[model samples]
Target chain A: MISSIFPSKNFFCLNKLSVCSDSFHLNTSLFYNEYSVILTFLFIATILSVIIILFSYILAVQNPETEKLSTYECGFEPYEDARHTFDVKFYLVAILFIVFDIETMFLIPWTNVLGQLDLVGFWSMIDFMFELSIGYVYIYCIGALDIH
Target chain B: MIVLIICIVLKILVVVVPLLISVAYFTIAERKIMGIIQRRKGPNVIGFLGLLQPLADGLKLFVKETIFPSNSNIIIFLIAPMLTFILSLIGWAVLPLSKQIVLSDLNIGVLYLFATSSLSVYGIIMAGWSSNSKYPFLGALRSAAQMISYEVSIGFIIINVCICAGSFNLSFIVLAQNNVWFVVPLLPMFFIFCVSMLAETNRHPFDLPEAEAELVSGYNVEYSAMTFALFFLGEYANMLLMSAFVSILFLGGWLPLVNLFPFNYLPGSLWFSLKLVLGVIFFIVTRATLPRYRYDQLMYIGWKSFLPLSLGYLLLSVGILISFNWLPT
Candidate 1:
């Protein structure tokens, strides 16, 4: 049943239990600690966070007020819907972040394999860095990152 | 099967319970320390030295009626704080308490932490939009953009650390520091990471999100009762998590300072906690001392300053490593 839930190319071994094999194989290269540990942690965290919220939710008394329920605008009624309150600057910030962020993402895998990549890999990444830096310099010159 | 399930659950509980407890105490500590800086008594009325203040605060928040805005989108509003709290806690699965004490010794530990921290923005966006309020929406925009901007530089900072340590695995990063902590060599990068960390966590000097004078408590302006408590908990938890990252990446996490008699006499986990406290103190002191950066200046520093600086440092460090044939495996 466990094997069907998280099928792996190799045995999915927890700390000691090998759910995918006949016997526990501690030495199996297929240590699923990394793979499933996050799933377990996320699962537990979700349950725990929800439980903490619910413990309060269940214990709290419900008091309803129309005035309290209205959106807060410091004693006055909201002049405009918050959703309609848009800033064009934020969109630019978001766009610029996504562009450079993806560029930086490429560095992660490169760093992991840097030793095997040798000097050729070194210069190539440096070249890429210069290219990105030029683009960043251009972005800065144009005041793309600035907001009032 | 039953035994395995029980064991997994137990291990998770061990990590999560202490984390939650420390987050509670972390709030109390911040208040107490901040009060001392300002020459006031901070929350000493509860249990001895207000150690139980967080619990009391939790109980008080829990008992109050939750006020949901009539104009708000109810569903996303509910999910937002839950998402923040969960994401904050989940990063710990990859953080090492000691050499063998990690919940997940994942090869991509750094990446996992990066992803979780980045994803935290969505919670704020969802909450602000759903609240249908003025300040929260504005606060959310500032915070979300601020976090996103700083995260780009933080990514480069991690690359700088990874180049020195030679693995995305956080444990390898820690163990690689046995001969010397990354701080001594990468002090500039370490300082940049700390500044970016402050912006990332929305703490003081960069806390435009909750610049109460302007934002009136920011993106969580509308949240009340337990939901607000979740955001509070999530913020502190993120602070704790970021501090742990600093310790692991730069301060020789879990490794004894000098590995000498007194420091080594204490356990590895204890050392890790001490470093975390150091980080927390740093956070509080910055909060007390530094004035909040204006929103525009905050953007200027994140992009124009830290971003360029970190990217250059990553390039230089990697270049140096390659030239010296010293890339760690």
Candidate 2:
């Protein structure tokens, strides 16, 4: 009863027929080909890495001079570990630079489109510039950009 | 589908290659700009007008050995700069240089950009943590805090623009400014956004994360050779992206300037590119002109000043929209 209902022979024959088809074989090859692109990229990347390493080894120098190996600071005797905490002013100045820098950055595109905008764009930019100038004044009053 | 793929490939190549080249020259531009500001010559011997200097620097970095510290997490150290570099590039996908030239015009393009920019902080964090060094770790922490804080104000500023334009689509936002750019009604918000972008990008003054006199090159202190180059590229790319955002949001993306003379015939993309270059020059100028900020002061500016100002601008825009019957009710 089980053998009559299962039809295992027919299933096996169908599987064999499907496997033997040229389209199925071609499909498998296509799958392999797609995988090979990624494989090729990885292979190329690895080769490049090896070549760079080998090249660097040829040019790499070894210097025992204590000064040469020390953390760089304009040839002045490098005082203190690089991790030693320094003035907060340096960070402040950097932040202020970015703020004003970005403000001016925004003005450029507005200026480009200003002519087509007529009085509207012109006045708009004036207003924007005016507002930005306030921040500039504030920053200046605090002396954020002052390097000394 | 095939055409779309080709278009995408071409767009990526066009944007990425020129962007890489520009980033390289930006280093030279920065030096030259600084020199001019400080009254000295900068890097003149490498080539004509020091044009070949960036190439020489690239070669030097390429030849240099990448030293992975024994105590460092090698996998994360490798992945951090790549992450930052890739994220920096991702923002360009949405920016419309001309009417038809954008890579992807997602409806929520602005939000998508903000999301991508936010993810970049993780790269900084990973770089600091994976290095197993104290300065980088501190730098990363400062960067993470600064970025997250300023992002809120930036988000609020963007919301003000959205309120005014009544769209999240970047192209739509630009089109909404057909008669006038939002820079007029949203001047205050635009101002806040600019400051926020500066802090967001960790540019000078806000560069506490990589303070040379303090953190010794910050998160990428452990990085060298091409690995370091990727981070440098990512930074300049981020600068470009921020500039692009300003162009798109407030300035009107790719919209021709008021049909003046020969300028009308010039493509919108050329205008956008010109704007971007001007933005780079502005970045350099600021670097020349300004000093860095104290950490606490940075926080104060973001939270105390810019945040409140942005919130006020957002409220003001909303009030105007509602009063003008622009709202759907």
Candidate 3:
């Protein structure tokens, strides 16, 4: 019955008090020390930044006015919606960037293995680059790369 | 466990206090330097030589009112600055000040740094979008696009360094620079990295996103009081973080100019700080010296020039390393 819920040997049911206790009791000192330092820093940093901001918030004046909160449009009221649809050109460039950025991510691990692959790996990357160049050229020719 | 926790907290306080103090002084330094460049006295009235100006500024900003923009996304409006402030501070955790100093020496320190920098974009975007104002919305959009563009080249440059160092750990990158700094071989990459860093931090001449003449302070236009202060602090902290990155990647981290006699006698952290200060000065100088680029030109440099140059350099470095059999084992 107990085994049905906890299929993996690594997964111990809390109902099995002795088994759970032993596994949980295993040494955590080494891992704990380094992580604790990070945790402490994060905790303190968060607290410090929060305290300063909160202190200011508490001490500062709270005078909300219709004029004060209104969006600044050269002192005239905003004429159009702030969230108007942006240029499609930005999307085009962004998509192109995403493709190349992902390519860089792939290249990182390949660098680590360059010793073993030798000339074969180099040529493979060249092949990859050739394909990338084709897409880049296509983008250039179409003027997708051009910022209007 | 409790005692250990206390010890960790104390260790953190040591790094935090100095960092906070430096962030304050960085603003003062920028003003003073910019003032001198313009041939004027700057901020000298507060405390002997304007030493207390930042504190006074902090006080003034704190006591001022925080105006919640009508019809804005109130929750996100409030969260944006705090997000920026906290994200900027956290990147220092994995940074190696010296062989002995670091908050946590994570194995994937480079990735950690990348993650934090990338996440900082969200804070800016959130600030801009939440303001429900036209100028900030446009500013936010520009910043997002600009950051994403530059990050590509920055990523490649870092990977190039990691390839030479044979580890993702930043300290190892520094150690790799012991014999000859990466800057000497990767001089072009260094310049590209510096320019990209300038854009990444939204400093001039790449500061189109916040072109005050056009955008009226951009994303932080609607922010005020402590909220504004948080954004201000966060931006300066990020500038310092980027300076640290330049130092660590190209200038041999905390190592002395030469590991000989008097130079070697200087503490590694001291050398690290000296290099960082120089980088900060360069950042301030660039701000004073250059005119802001047009928005399109900013994108052109990032995508057309930097992206291709860094990518091509990566390929060339790989080719050379293979031919010379200099690939790190």
Runs with alpha carbons beyond 4 Å of true place in candidate 1: A1-31
lDDT (Cα atoms) of all candidates against the true structure: 0.86, 0.69, 0.83
Q: What TM-score goes with each of the models?
A: 0.93, 0.71, 0.91
Model 3 residue B54 distance off true place after TM-score fit, in angstroms: 0.7
The list of candidate 2 runs beyond 4 A from truth reads A1-148, B1-7, B327-329
Interface Cα RMSD for candidate 3? 5.3
Q: Count clashes in each candidate, considering only residues at least 3 apart in sequence or on different chains.
A: 0, 22, 0
Q: Which tens-of-lDDT digit does each residue in A1-148 have in candidate 3?
A: 3333223333211122224445545224324644556666667767877897788878877888899989888878887768878878767767887898888777766655555464666687778977987887787688776786
True contacts kept of each: 0.80, 0.05, 0.61
Off by over 4 Å in 3: A1-36, A116-118
The most accurate candidate by TM-score is 1
Better structure of 2 and 3 per TM-score: 3
Report how far residue B76 has shifted in candidate 3, in Å. 0.9
Taking all chains together, the TM-score of candidate 3 against the true structure is: 0.91
Give residue B42's error in model 2 in angstroms. 1.4
lDDT of 3 at B282: 97
lDDT of 1 by residue, A1-148 (tens): 4333223422223223334464445433335546566777788888877887787777788888888798888888887787774889998999999988998888777776677664566677788989988999899899897888
lDDT of candidate 2 over B155-267, digit per residue (tens): 76776676566556688788877788877777777777777888899998688888888878888877777778778878888998998898788887777667677877889
Q: Model 1 residue B163 lDDT?
A: 80
